[model samples]
Target: MRKLIAISSGILLLALSLAWWMNSRQPQPVELMPILTGQPEYCVTCHSDLPEISASHPVETFGCVSCHGGERLALDADLAHSTMRGGANPSDLSVAEISCGGSSCHTGSEADDRDHIQRVMTSVQSTYAGAIANIRYTFGAQTDLTAHQGINAITDERTQTGITALEIFNPTLESNPMIQKFGEECFTCHINAVPREGESYTRQTGCAACHSTEQHQLTTAISYTQCNTCHNRGNYDLRTMTFVERTDHLTNRLEEYYQPIAQFTQCEYTLDCVDCHTRSEVMGDGDLHSNQKDIQYVQCKTCHGTLTELPLTKTLTDPNDIAFRMAFLKPVVDLKLGDTILVTEQGEPLWNTRVLPDGTYEMIGKATKQKFNFRPVMGTACEQKPNEQESHFCHECHAVER
Candidate 1:
C-alpha cells in the first residue's frame, strides 16, 4: 500500500507540470493601431473642434503612430505619454525643451518665431467674435496667399503661376477695438467658442467689418471705380477712396492718381491696380512693384533677359485690352538682378535684358531700337533726376546722386 501511494503522488506531479508548460507556450495577443507618440490622443479628446483650420493644431488628426516612432501599448497614461528612458530619468535635460514647434517639421522662420508663438497663443486663449463680416474679412484678408487660393475660394489652381484674386493683406485686426464692440460672439466662425444658436435677422453680414477698414476699404461688391466717390484722388492730403495715408511723404514715387474704371463713361481707358502697383510679397513668375526710388535698372528687364542679353521694351496694355498710347500712359515693369525684357525705341525693338524682375519699368522717354542686344548700357536718359548714369539705376543699390 505504501509503494502504491508513492507512485500516485509522482503521477499527480507530472500532470501538474505538463499543464503549466502548455499554458506558458500559448501565443500573446496582438494590437493593430497603437497610440505610440505624444499625448495626442489625450489632447484631441478636448481640441477636435476644427480639424480643417491649418493654423490650428494639425498633429491631432495624423493619429499617434505618425509622430511617436516607438512602441504603441502602455499599461497607463503615465507610461504611454512619458518620454522613453533606458533606465531611470537620465541627467540630460534636453528632453524637457522638446516642443510641438521645435520639431523639424514645423520650424517657423527665424524672424517669425516669437510672432508665430504669440499668434498661436492668441488663437488658443481668446474667444473669436461671431460677426459674419468680421469672419469673411478675416478669412479673406489673412488666408495664405502663397497657396494661390484666397480664403473665399473653394479651390486653388493658380499656385504655380503665382496669381490669385484672393487677398489677405493684414491678419491681426481681430484684436482691434472695432472687433471688440460686438462682444464675445463677435465673429460667426468663432461660434465654436460661444455656442449661441439663434437665427436673428439683426446680425450684420460682411459689411460692418469691411466698412471699418482704415485702408483698402472693402465694400460688399463695391466696384473699384467708385473709390474716388468719398476720396480726393489728387490732393494726397485728404482720404483717397477711404485710405488715409499715414505718413507725410508717399512711398510710391511712380504713382499717379488712381482712376477707377466704374466712373469712366466715354473715357475708353481702364487699368488694373496691379499694372501700376507691385505686390508687397516677392514671387518668381509674376510682375512686382517696389515703393523705393524709381530706376531703369530695377525695371522689367530683370527676369525675361537671358544671361547674355537685356530685355526690349514693349507697349503697355490695360485690363480692357486697350493699348495704352505712349503719350497717355507708360508701361511699368519690375527689374531685378537677372531678368529678360524687350527694350524698344520708337516702334522698334532693341535689346533683351538678363536681370530678374524687381522694380517698375515705366516709359519715361521714346528711344527707337538703336543698339541690338546690348548688355546693361550706361548713361541712360532720366525722367526725374538726370545727373546720375543709369547702368545700375535706383539709388537704393548704386547710391549715385540724381
Candidate 2:
C-alpha cells in the first residue's frame, strides 16, 4: 500500500509539471478593447503577427470579432474559429448582411451612394445573366436574348430597366442538353461562384472577389491582374463544353492584358480596367440588366472629344457631390471645389481627371498613380468622324500590333 501511494504521487507530480510547461509555451493573452463594439477581445494573442487590415478598418476600431465573427474571449484555436462568419471571408454574400452590412456600412441609402451590397447582388457579374441568356438563346431554350433567370432568384424593387426580377436558374431543370452543359460548365466565372481550381483562376466569392487581393487585404487600387482572373484567364469551348486554359506564355503587357484575338489600343493595355471603368459599370447601377453592353457606356469620346465638339466638363461646386466621395475613396488626386473635370455622356464624373490651364486634361491612373496629360481630338490633326466615335472606330487607326 505504501509503494502504491508513492507511485501515484509521482505520476501526479509528472502530470502537473507537463501542464505547467505547456502553459508556459502558450502565448500571453493580449487584450484589445475595440472602440466600435466596446468589447474586449484576445484574438491578437494568437494573431500578433498580422498587419493592420487597411487604413479604414483599424484594429483599434474594429476588432477581429467585428468582421471575423470568432469568440472574443476564447483562446483555443478551434473554439475561436468555430463561429467565424464566412470562414476566411466575411464579405461573402452568404453572411455579408450580418458581417459587413448596416446603414453606416455597405447597405445604406442609394442616394447616399452606400448601397454597395444591393448593387452587387443585382449586378451581372454576380448573376451571370448575360452568359445564361446567350447560351439559352443559342440552344433554342429561349426565344429572345433577354435574361429571365440568374444563378439565384433576386428581385430589384427600384429597377430602371424593365427586368425587375430573375428566377433562379437550375441546370438540372434545364431541358436542353446544350443549355444544361452550359449551366454545368460556364457557372464558374461569376462573383458568387467558387472560381475554377487553379493558380490562374484563384479568387474569392462576393465582394472580396473584386475588392480583396490574394493576401486577403481589401483595397480600392485594383489592378488589371485582378480583373484578368475572371475576364481573360481562358475561353470556353462551346462545342466540347469545356474551358480551354490559355497556354501561351505572354511576353508583353499588351499580350498579358487581353487575348490574342482581341484588338486593343495602347491606352487600353496601358491603363488598368478600373482606370476606365466607372464604379457603376463594374459594380452595377442597382438594377438587373440583360448584358454587359447595357451598363458599360464608357465610349472613347467620353474622354477624348469628337472633331465637332469638346468633351463635356462639370465644375465641382457642391461640397456633397458624388465626385468628392469618389475622390475620398481613391485619394490619388486632390479634387478641390470649383475645379473643372470631365463627365461621361450619362453625366458620371471622371473624378481622377482635371482640366489644366493649357486646355489639356490631366488624368491620374487609379491603380498605378501615374500622371498622363492628353488633349482632346477637337483641335488635333486626327481624321476621326464626329458620328463614328466608338472605341472600335478609334481602334481602326490606333490598334497596336499584338
By lDDT, the best candidate is 2
Residue-level lDDT tens digits of model 1 in 288-363: 1111121113332332232334344543333222122112222222323233334432222221222224432332
The C-alpha TM-scores of every prediction are: 0.21, 0.96
Q: Which stretches of candidate 1 lie over 4 Å from their true place?
A: 1-151, 161-309, 313-376, 379-402
Q: Could you tell me which residue pairs clash in candidate 2?
A: none
lDDT, model 1, position 274: 23
User: What lDDT does each candidate get?
Assistant: 0.28, 0.89
lDDT (Cα, tens digit) per residue for candidate 2, span 132-208: 88888888888999989998899987779989899999988889888888887888899978999988788888888
Q: Give the TM-score of candidate 1.
A: 0.21
Candidate 2: clashing residue pairs, number? 0
Error of 1 at 226 (Å): 9.7
Clashes of each: 57, 0
